[model samples]
Target: MATFALIHGAGDAGWYWHLVEAELRGRGHDTVAPDLPCDDDAAGLVEYADAVVRAVGDRTGNLVVVGQSLGGFTAPLVCERVPATLLVLVAPMIPAPGEAVTDYFANTGYDEEPGGDTIAVFYQDVPPALAAAAVEHGRHQSEARLGEPSPLTTWPGVPTRVVLGRDDRLFPPQYLRRVTHDRLGITPDEIDSGHTPALSRPRELAALLDSYVEAVARV
Candidate 1:
């Protein structure tokens, strides 16, 4: 049985993955969604990765590390340390080799106000009224982390899965598809939900992942 480590996106916390984690557990899979120290600050990647590694503890079982949005930057690092069975990217913000998260957002087309609760609203998928709720709960990330580029010389050869939010207002589905298919050479599983599938569409997201896990076992 493989353990699942879920890393959340920016302007968000481990709370976001609660539903999906429960669902995975229900299916008899081990899981953990750690709270990264990324709040109002931009959070450096090294610190974020270290936090993930720490939370993973000494569990030497087969692992499935799922990185959501900003979490994509840290997931690969976990893959580097542990014996990862899979690296799953949920509409990930994949930083190129030696490229930082800042690079991805700079050209990401969304407007970045860069201050207080205002920044949270810009990245949230919930309605305007609920977006504010995320601000308080969201952890303050370190700006230094955003500047630290992902340290992957090459893609992890281990099995990888990517889940795309079809109606993702943040990372357009088509764009994500292009990258996963044409660029990465992997046909990612698709979800017709928003950027926050674990929150917005937990059932669908979990069902899809359940199927993939089964599929992987047979391979």
Candidate 2:
């Protein structure tokens, strides 16, 4: 079984991945979803990666590192420190080496895109009760990490994959297509959901993750 080291995005803790974790565990895989120090102004990208590495502790074999949204920047750094079998990005903000997190939106033209309603953009497909809880669970994201350049000097050598939600408003599908292509030379696999697919479509997300393990085995 593969161990999925699931990393959540900005302002969110490991709680963001709770449902997806359940689905992955049900499929008989071990999973680690750590609460990042996103609220701590002192915590930067290195600290972010440190939390995940420590959470992983020394388990070996078939590590699949999955990152969502801003977690994208931290995931690649984890691969550099772990024997990750594959790196999966779910609606991620793919980063360039040395690019600061704050610069990401403007550098990628995300700032120019028209914004949408908060509910419609991020939690449109999520269950109402759960969505409310998610909002309540959010923490204050700090600028310490956002202001620093991503310390990934180079992308890790592990095989990589990108997944994008077709109905995503926060990061529109068309926009992500260009970002993924320009940054990673990849065409993301599309899913029928909004930005937070783990909460909105956990089963389908789990299945897609499982398929990645199968694909790696084939290689």
Candidate 3:
């Protein structure tokens, strides 16, 4: 069995991964989903990483750290403190040394803002009921989190994989592909969902994660 530590993106809590968590536990794997302090004024990347590390305390297993969206930034920091078997990024924001999240967006050429419908941009493929609930329950994210410089000097030495949503409007497939290649020297695998796959396509996401773990075990 493997342990999956799921880190959510900005403006989201661990509840965002509830579906994915259910799917993973159903497959007999251990899972931890930490609620990041994205809305708190005092919390930044370091605090975010600390929450994830605390959730992962003393777990002995094949540990995998999975990050989604802005979580891409926080997950690597956790890998620096913990022993992870692999790091899986889901539509992540790849940061350079001392780069802030705001700078990363501009650097990545994501020039267009959402045309007023977050559901269209983020949850196009999700079920309507779930999407509506998510929109209603979404929390306000702190802007301070975006300006903090990422503390990583280099990518963590653990094995890594990037997964992109083929229909993601927020971060298009081609853009993520280019960034992944330029930054991580790898290509991302694609799924048939939008930005928030854990809500829209949890089963598929879980299967892909399990497959990655199996593939890594063989090596």
Candidate 4:
């Protein structure tokens, strides 16, 4: 069974992947969703990747590292440290080497895009109760690392995939398409959900992830 290293986004905890974890576990795969030190004033992307590596320990087998949103910045770092078999980015803030996280918006022209209400952007498709719980589960995302450049000098050699939320408003589909292609020369696979698909469409999300494993095994 492959071990899925699930990394959450900015201000989010491991709980963000609970539903997806349950689904994966039920399908006979192991998953690790480590709570990043997002609230710590001293912790940055390196520390975030360290948490995931520590959680992984010595487990051996296919290692699929999945990162969401801001976690995108840390996922490749993990792949660089570990023998990751696949790197999957879910509605990610795909980063450039040496680019500060804070500069991503302006660099990608996200700042020029039309904006939406926070809730409407992130949780429009998520159920109200679960979305509320997601909000409560959020922590204070420290700005300590916002100005630090991403440490990845080049993309990891591991196979990579990008998944896009078709209805996402925070990073709209069109925007993500442009960014993904521009940065990675790849077209993302689209899903019929908003930004937080783990909460809004766990089963579908899990199935998609599972399919990747199957596809990789054939290679």
Candidate 5:
């Protein structure tokens, strides 16, 4: 069985992959999702990458590293350190040179005030149930970490998969389309879910992970 390292977005713990993790394990794959030090600005990109590397333990056999949201920006760095078989980005925070996480909030018209709840970054047409869940799981992020550029330019030259949420509001569809297609030079698989697919669409998301592992074995 191949190993998969799952990373969650801002404010969310490793539990983000609860559903997907269970499904993948049932399918005979090993999965590890570590809780990132979300509240710590003391640890920057390298620290985040280190956390992921530790989660994988020894880099034996085929390993796939999946990063969601903010974890996306840091996943490539982990691949740089670990011998991952493939890198999968799910509705992640795409990084650029000299760009900060604050840039997204500034340009994307997001405000951090709503009766103590921060603005919802992704999912525009959210159902009431999903909206409430999203808010609870969402957490405020440190500008220092995101503002710092990703240490590595790109992930290893493995089979990389960019899975886009068809209805993600946090990162604009146009930008995700461009980065996944043009910037990264990878045609991503499409998922008809909001930003938090792991929470809402676990089986569908798990299937995507299974597909990636299977495809890599063939390669």
Candidate 6:
């Protein structure tokens, strides 16, 4: 069984992965979902990567690291420090060298203006009850962390995959496809969900992850 280290997006905690973690565990895989110190003024990408590395401590097995949204910036750093078999990015923010998350929006042609409705952007495909709970439990993300430049000069050597939410209003599939091709040089696989699929479509997400792992093993 592979150990899956799941990293959540901005303003989110490890609790966001509860559903997906349970699903993976049911499928007999070990999982680690660490709460990132995104709100801490002192924590940046290095600190985030350190947290993930600590969570995966001393595990010996095939390991898969999955990052969602802003967690994408941290995942590769973890892979650089550890030996991950695969790195999967879910509706992720692909950061260029020396580019901060704030700069990534305009660089990728993503809408940088604020004031969009959260429900329309993130919860469109999620269940109402769960989405409501997520909004209520959400914490503030630190600008210091988001504004910091990524430490990576190159992508990690680990095999990588990108999973795009087909209906994601925040990062639409077409936009993700273009960005993934240009940045990661791969075509992303699509899923039928919105941005928060771990909470909204855990079973499907888990199955997709399992398929990716099996496919990677064959190669």
User: lDDT for each of the candidates?
Assistant: 0.74, 0.92, 0.90, 0.91, 0.74, 0.89
For 1-219, candidate 2 gives per-residue lDDT tens digits of: 999999999998899999988999999999999999999989999999999999998865889999999999999999999999999999999999999999999899885454666566689899999988888888999986588888999999999999999998888899999999999997899999999999999999999999999999999
Model 3, C-alpha of 213: deviation from truth (Å): 0.5
Report clash pairs, candidate 6: none
What digit string (tens of lDDT, one per residue) describes model 6 on residues 90-140?
989987877888899889988634236877688877788988888886778
Candidate 4: residue 49 lDDT (0-100): 92
- Residue 181 alpha-carbon offset, candidate 1, angstroms: 2.9
C-alpha lDDT of residue 16 in model 5: 67
Q: Model 5: what TM-score? A: 0.83
Q: Is candidate 3 or candidate 4 better by lDDT?
A: 4
Which regions of candidate 3 deviate over 4 angstroms? none
Misplaced by over 4 Å in model 5 are 97-139
Residue-level lDDT tens digits of model 1 in 125-215: 5555445555666765556556656776677777888998876766677777766775478787887776778866777887887776777
> Can you tell me which runs of candidate 4 are displaced by over 4 Å?
112-117
Clashes of each: 13, 0, 0, 0, 5, 0
Q: Per-residue lDDT for 55 in model 3?
A: 96
Model 5 poorest ten-residue lDDT run: 110-119
The residue pairs in collision within model 2 are none
lDDT of 5 at 79: 80
Please provide the root mean square deviation of candidate 4 (C-alpha atoms, Å): 1.2
Candidate 2, residue 47: lDDT: 96
lDDT of 5 by residue, 87-206 (tens): 899987656544566675454444433232233545344556756766776555665666665566644666678888877765556667766665577677888886778866788999
Q: What is the lDDT of residue 208 in candidate 5?
A: 83
Q: Residue 217 lDDT in model 4?
A: 94
Residue-pair clash count for candidate 4: 0
